[model samples]
Target: MEQSNTLLDVKKLEVSYGHVDALKGVDVTVNQGEIVVLIGANGAGKTTLLDTILGINTPRSGSIQYNGTDITGRSADINVREGLTIVPEGRGVFTSMTVTDNLLLGAHHNMHESSDKIERVYQWFPILKERSDQMAGTLSGGERQMLAIGRALMSAPRIILVDEPSIGLAPIIVNNIIEILVNLNKEGYTILLSEQNAYKALKIAHRGYVLETGQVVLSGTAEELLEDPAVKDAYLGA
Candidate 1:
């Protein structure tokens, strides 16, 4: 795909924390309206890559381009305003705040009224609306995940970075969340999902990349990855 037409492009990206190198010359792209999944074991640098893309962690080298603009050193707040939002790992909701309050904060950068956006989020996750006045900390794991994704939608983002949406949930709840993400992608929301559940991630993804020790060791269409003997053995336990 051409760089100009891509929604996000990471070229030779590297990142480190102090003396520990996390991402090593990683490259990936998310086209408009596509679901791209990153699959790996724990400590494969998936979270580090997403954090770097969102400017939560600065890149040690290389460039990050979003919608044809360089956003390498942009702040997280600015990146969110510019339509890149992340529903981070651990369902990073503001536990101390009301569900409604958390959603409102997601739209802080927008100067216009957020009533419409709030309504849209509620429509996407009606359970959130039901628990609108409840403290975010009190919600169950699945509800918290919904609230997190709903909060990101409040920003009206064009692209969403989701890390481990299936973490710590029952199998049924994980399936529901994956279905919601697929539906969101169908509705033209570009997504880059980082996951440790390779089987589940491949089921909903259009394409996938497998990372090992900070390098992309395997990549292909989801169907291809699902059937590959190596992927099946290492990730799917087939």
Candidate 2:
């Protein structure tokens, strides 16, 4: 990739809710075709950062640039149309809706093309096809995660902000999710993953940023982070 091939760039971001600051001057970048993971504990501002990037949460001060265009504080719908999408934490599927209907909802920006978009999502997740007519509330956690990802894929996103794919999943299911993310990255989808499962996140990430109390405490190539004593002690439980 060229030096200028940054797909998503966030600089000096700060976000607050009431009097509590959630993020403080954070900087992160995801290059084209790269899988960059953000590792942090709960309340460490991981979700806040992703939400800011997706425009679900507005930053108090910062710049978010996508494809070289300044998209800071744009509405989430407009940002999605610009080829940025998020598979939110807790696998935000519409529980009462059928799998197919939920997938169709993702194509709100291109409703007329929704039917055409679904087959691609089904191909990525065949189980969703089998459960197409079934209510999403009936699906397992793993299946729901798949549906969430598939729904995001319906938009044909350029950069995917995935928040904690491992939450509430069994080990095997987490592995499956990780493999799916790796496969998607191989297919050239840029991914920005926020994971509290630090060891696993670092293993799959090309590069990583470690956040603590709304500040970026550390950042490096994944290999460098994995071998760092501080990372091992704090996050890896080594």
Candidate 3:
């Protein structure tokens, strides 16, 4: 209940791919212990923003600050080592590897404490433990997502950037994922959730930003966004 500090700050961010602009002067922030949702349609720059922050893509301009340090151009591995990690959109687990092996890959940087980190991840996704020796490619969509998230946790990250977690998932499974995110937030993990399910995203968010064509069109507390007329018609079907 003491969330008051900014953990991640993105200022005037601009990113482009060859000739196409992906993020244009987008400013955003994630406070400690807060679940800040970014609701946008496909190609709205949500993933680009997350990726740019995680160092997957280089930004054309702007600054990315994590815990008050300017890390605009930091490498992904160093960023992960410094407590920032992402659960990519496609649940990019090692399909050929076993569940336990995949999780162990996440602890590559912190292998000195690999066992303890793996145990912590198991507590969050026991199905991972149940399927420890099973190949990741054979797991269901929901289980794969759990492994992706659990794998990120193995790095002992302070901020988790979850990209489109509900993509290709059933309603009940989406609900389960949302609840797991809420629980993770309660356990003190700051999350920046990029989601297309606007209503569901806003429901559990502390604050939210609405992205449109690489720009932030709206932002406010969860309650305000949920009640906004534009939000209802465009996203909630209200």
TM-score on alpha carbons, each prediction: 0.97, 0.98, 0.97
Clashing pairs in 3: none
Model 3 worst lDDT window (10 residues)? 1-10
Evaluate residue 166 in candidate 2 and report its C-alpha lDDT on the 0 to 100 scale: 97
**Which stretches in model 3 have alpha-carbon errors above 4 Å?**
1-4
| lDDT string, candidate 1, 44-134, tens digits | 9999999989989989899999999999989999999999999989999999999999999899999476989899888899999999999
Clashing pairs in 2: none
lDDT of 2 by residue, 1-238 (tens): 5549999889999999999999999999889999999998899999999999999898999898999999999999999998999999999999999999999888878887788789888888999999999999999999999999999988889999999999999999999999999999999999999998999988999999999999999999999999999999999999
Tens-place lDDT per residue, model 3, 1-238, is 3234889999999999999999999999999999999998899999999999999899999999999899998999999999999999989999999999989888778888898888888888888899999999999999999999999998889999999999999999999999999999999999999999999999999999999999999999999999999988898888
Note the residue pairs that clash in candidate 1.
Answer: none
Estimate the lDDT of model 2: 0.94
Q: Choose 1 or 2, whichever is better by lDDT.
A: 2
